[model samples]
Target: IHRQAHLVEGFSEPFRRAVEREIRRLGVEIWAGCQVKAFGPEHVWLSDGTELIAQTRLWAGGFQVPSWLSTCGLPTGPTGALLVDKYLRVQGSEHILAVGDCADFVWGSRLLPKIGVYAVRQGPIAAQNLLRLIRGQPLIPYRPQATVFVCVTVGNRVAVAEKGRLVWRGYSATVLKNFFDWLYMRKLKPLRWQEFFY
Candidate 1:
């Protein structure tokens, strides 16, 4: 169940369709543009006057920040995430930087999506900028790439990959997704400075 008709927003049309197609193929019904009116022990009512009888329901809707963000007296967006400039620095604090899901980094008029991929890419750049700041050098601006690839795991064996207009699914996509996941986890392992180069 989702508010958007497309599974992934701000992605290419072909990619969004591919994700929806794979999801339906897995025999999971998708309720797009659905507004949950009410819920009962064994059923859920939608705004469209449709009652769905289901034994299980999962609410994967929206994101929120910790209450302490507001209490900290830092500038925050409507979602309560810390407002940050192009360099990922906090609005008023030169030493403090914000990144990941807790930050509201805007490019032009749009705020960047709160996704893991952006956060992963932002980390190294943020670190570099911090070093530059420490050396009294100009900080490098964080310019987000136009195209961002995303992979979604639909089920045990099914997954979807999207990069602009390109899309991939099924077993190969699942393997590719798993490979990326493994690579991410592997990088998290503690290693010596010499091991990093190797």
Candidate 2:
């Protein structure tokens, strides 16, 4: 279920359609442009006075900034994310950097969506920029990628992925998803003396 008209609103129309197809194929209902008024252990009540049996209900809420950030007197975006400059530094403040969901990282005229891809890309640059700031060296400005990869595993072993004009589905997309998931999970593995280079 999604409150938005499109489940993946900012994504390409084809990507969104592909994902929706996979989800529907899995026998899961799509409740777009709707809201759940309340949910009990075995049932869910919708805002339109409809109740449905829901054995397992999953609710994914939107992100919210900490209340204390408002008290800090820093400039914030419409969603209350701290405004950040190109260098990922908090606007008007040096030695303070904000990224990911907590930051309103703007590119051109719009703020980048709060997604993991942007956060992962911004992380190393933010680290290097922070170091450069301390050493009085030039801080590197973060450039949002022209085409970021997006993948979603809908259900079973199926998935959908997109990058630029490229779109993928089913087995190929699932393989790509697994490969990226492996790379991400690799970082969580502990280092050993023999594998220090990893």
Please give each candidate's TM-score: 0.78, 0.85
Q: Which stretches of candidate 2 lie over 4 Å from their true place?
A: 62-67, 187-198
Q: Which prediction has the highest TM-score against the true structure?
A: 2
Q: Where does candidate 1 stray beyond 4 Å?
A: 65-80, 108-110, 190-198
Residue-level lDDT tens digits of model 2 in 1-198: 677787876677899999999899999789888789999989999887889998987767766688777789888876688999999988999889988888998788777877788998899999999889889999999999998888888876688999999888887777776777667767878534333211
Model 1: per-residue lDDT, tens digit, 1-198?
A: 676676677556777788888788889888888788999999999978899997788888566687898899989975689999989998998988889888998888888878787999899989999899999999988888887768887877778887766788877777777776667767888544433221
Q: What is the lDDT of candidate 1?
A: 0.81
lDDT of each: 0.81, 0.83
Maximum-lDDT candidate? 2
lDDT (0-100) at residue 23 of candidate 1?
80
Instruction: Tell how far residue 83 is off in model 2, in angstroms.
Output: 1.4
